[model samples]
Structure formats: structure tokens, C-alpha cells
Target: MPTILVADDDANIRELVCLFLRNDGFDTVEAKDGKEALTVYTSVHIDLVVLDIMMPNMDGWALCKELRKRSPDLPLLMLTARGETWEKVKGFELGTDDYLTKPFDPLELTVRVKSLLKRYKMAFTQTIQFGSITLDRKTYKVLCGANSLVLPLKEFELLYKLSGTPGQVFTREQLIDQIWGMDYAGDDRTIDVHIKRLRERFVGTPDFCIETVRGLGYRLEIMS
Candidate 1:
């Protein structure tokens, strides 16, 4: 069973979340503050975290940042009373998977959690083979034939996206929107940097070709 950590300062809110998640067949652990959340997370093998932004001892922003440093792929869903766009943006920047403002529907929360888990699978799977390279999605470890290559998260996700569609071309805009979600401001250069890094890591690998179209965008070059 999937375990979820629900951290909210308000007792009623925490109980409500726990009840809803438990009804959905998820095992839940509750925490009254961010500090308790971290402690519970360390003690138990939590599959996902639902964190409220406002709390005593520690805040959700700090917790999210710290957790991402320890486990980059740990799915985080931030709950906040502040519904401002900047707050939501900040949450994403801190590596939060999703954001829900106060007074959110229980069904929406469940749906968001399910979606994050689905993406987490794509990001943390082992032994994703494309061309001749075997990329471990979980640890971002890449292996070409018998040799292991180190690749960063952005580069790995870029390659993973391209590998899913061998002959398809993705514009820089599309890549930015898809990968960064609402985090980036449609910067084409970010896409370029990741693509360059991917090319450098898999330099001589025929299956790791990222071809650029002059008037179009970029695509995974299918090497025959």
C-alpha cells in the first residue's frame, strides 16, 4: 500500500485529509508541523507527502527544499492558504510536484496525488533502454553498452522525453512548457543547455542523437 504523510498545523484539516486518503485505500501518517513531518518521513518509508505551507517550528517551503536536496524524486504536494501566483511559482521552484490552495476539494487532492505518482514512475524507473544506452530513470544513471555515464536530471529528462518519440521533433517552446511546467518563462536557452549537456554525455552513442531542425526545433535522430 502507498503511504502518504499529511502535515498540517490545523488538526481538523489534517484529520480531513487523513480520512479522505484512507477512504481512497492509502495508508496515511499525520504530522502537526513541518518538523514532525520530517521526523515521520525519516522514520517511515513514505511514498508521498502532502504538506501545508503554514506551520510552526518549520515551514513547508523550507521542508520542501530540504527534502529535495535529500531525495529529488520524492513526490511533494504543497497545501497553502495563500493562493497567489507567486506563491505557487515559488512552490514549483522548490521542487513541489503540485499545489493546492485552501478549501480544495478532496477529490481534486486525490487526483493530483495520483498524477504525481504516475509521473514519479516515469522519473524513477530502472533500466530505460533507448538505442544502445540503458538509462536508469530512478537514479539518473546512464550506461552505454558496458560503461556507465553520469547525467544530470535535466539532461536525463530531455533524453527520456526524446526517446519516447524517436522520430518526433519537439520545439524548444514545447520542451520548456512540458518539462518545466509553469516554472520557466518559456526560455529557449534552457532547452538548448539541456540538449547540449545530453549530447556531451552520450557523445559517441548513435542512439543518443538529438538533431536540430534549421527552421523547426529539435528531435531524437533515429540512427539506422
Candidate 2:
């Protein structure tokens, strides 16, 4: 069973959320504020975190950023009373995998948690293969037939991320955060340049292709 960290200042809300999660078969640890949450998180093996925006000592935004820095693959969900669009945007920018407003249905929250976990599990592999190409994350090398190609760090990471979740569209902002880090100050178009280079590099390979979703983002598709 996955252990979840539930952080909220409201004692009642915290307990309620914990109760629901426990009933749903997830082991949980609770924290009253972001400071306590960070302590608990570092002390234990937490698979995911559900946090509130407002808290004394430290706010969820700071906690989220810190947590993302600690574990880029860890799942984070923002559960707060602040349901504004800007708040949601900020949460995503800070690396929250999902968001739930106050007065949320416990069932819906559980479903989203399960979904995030499933997605994470699917994308956690160290190696991926399609057709004749093999991407080895441990060695940061791509093996194609008798040839082995070593790519730049960013390019390899971007390719690994896309190939890990083939056919899943990733927004430019999402790519930037996951690949370039949340603090990256460069233009988002840098992704485009990298993508173009990747396309050129693999033009002769007929196994896979990366597609751009008009006005959305990109997805890698297996040609075979």
C-alpha cells in the first residue's frame, strides 16, 4: 500500500481526509502545517502528498517547490479552499500533479490519487524500447540495432520522458517544469528547438515519431 502525506492546518479537515484515505486502503501520515509536513516527508517514504495552500510556518507553494526539488517523480496534489484559476495554475507551476478545491468529494479525491499513482508507475521505468530502438536510462544511451547513440543530457531526458508515456500529450509548460526544472528562466521555445533536433536525428528511424498537438503540446507515437 502507498503511504500518503496529508498536510493541512485544519485539524478537522486533516482528520477527515486521513479517515477517507485510510478507508480507501492508503496508509497516511498527517501534518498540521507545511513545516511539520516537510519534516514528516523527509522522515518517511511517502508516495504522494496532498497539501493545503494556507498554513502557518510555511505555505503549500513553498512546500511544493521544495518537495519537487527533492523528488521530481513524487506525486503532489493541492487540496485547498483557494479554488481560483490562478491558484490552480500556480500549483501546477510549482509541481503539483493535481488539484482539488475545498468541499471536494472524498471519492473524487481518491480517484484522482489512484490515477496519479497509476500514471507515475507507468512512467517510472529505467528503460524503454520500441521497434529496434532501446532507451537505457541508467546509461543515458539509446541503442539502435548495431549502433549506440549518446545524446545530450536535456535531449535524452526529454526523449525519455516522452517515450515513457507514449501517446500522452505533454504541454510545453509541463515539459519545461519536468525537464528544465521549475526555476528555468529560458524561453519555452527551447523545447521546439530540441524537438526539431530530435526529429532530425531520428529521421531515418521508422520506429517512433514525436507529434505536436496544435495549440496544446507534444506526444511521441510509435510508428510500428
User: Best candidate per lDDT, number?
Assistant: 2
lDDT for 170 in candidate 1 is 58
| Model 1 agreement with the true structure over 1-224: per-residue lDDT tens digits | 79999999999999999899899899999999889988998999999999999999999999998888788768899999878866765676676767789899998998888766766765455556756677677777777878887776777778877665454455666577667865786567888888887777667877657888554467775577
Q: Give candidate 2 misplaced runs (Cα > 4 Å).
A: 127-174, 177-186, 192-224
lDDT of 1 at 180: 81
In candidate 1, what residue range of length 10 has the lowest lDDT sum? 164-173
Clashes of 2: 0
Instruction: Kindly list the per-residue Cα lDDT of model 2 for residues 139-186, writing each as its tens digit.
Output: 999998889998999999999998886665667899998889879999
> Global lDDT of each model?
0.79, 0.87
Compared to the true structure, candidate 1 yields what TM-score?
0.63
- Displacement of residue 81 (Cα, Å) in model 2 is 1.8
Candidate 1: Cα lDDT at 92: 65
Model 1 residue pairs with clashes: none
What 10-residue stretch in candidate 2 is worst by lDDT?
85-94
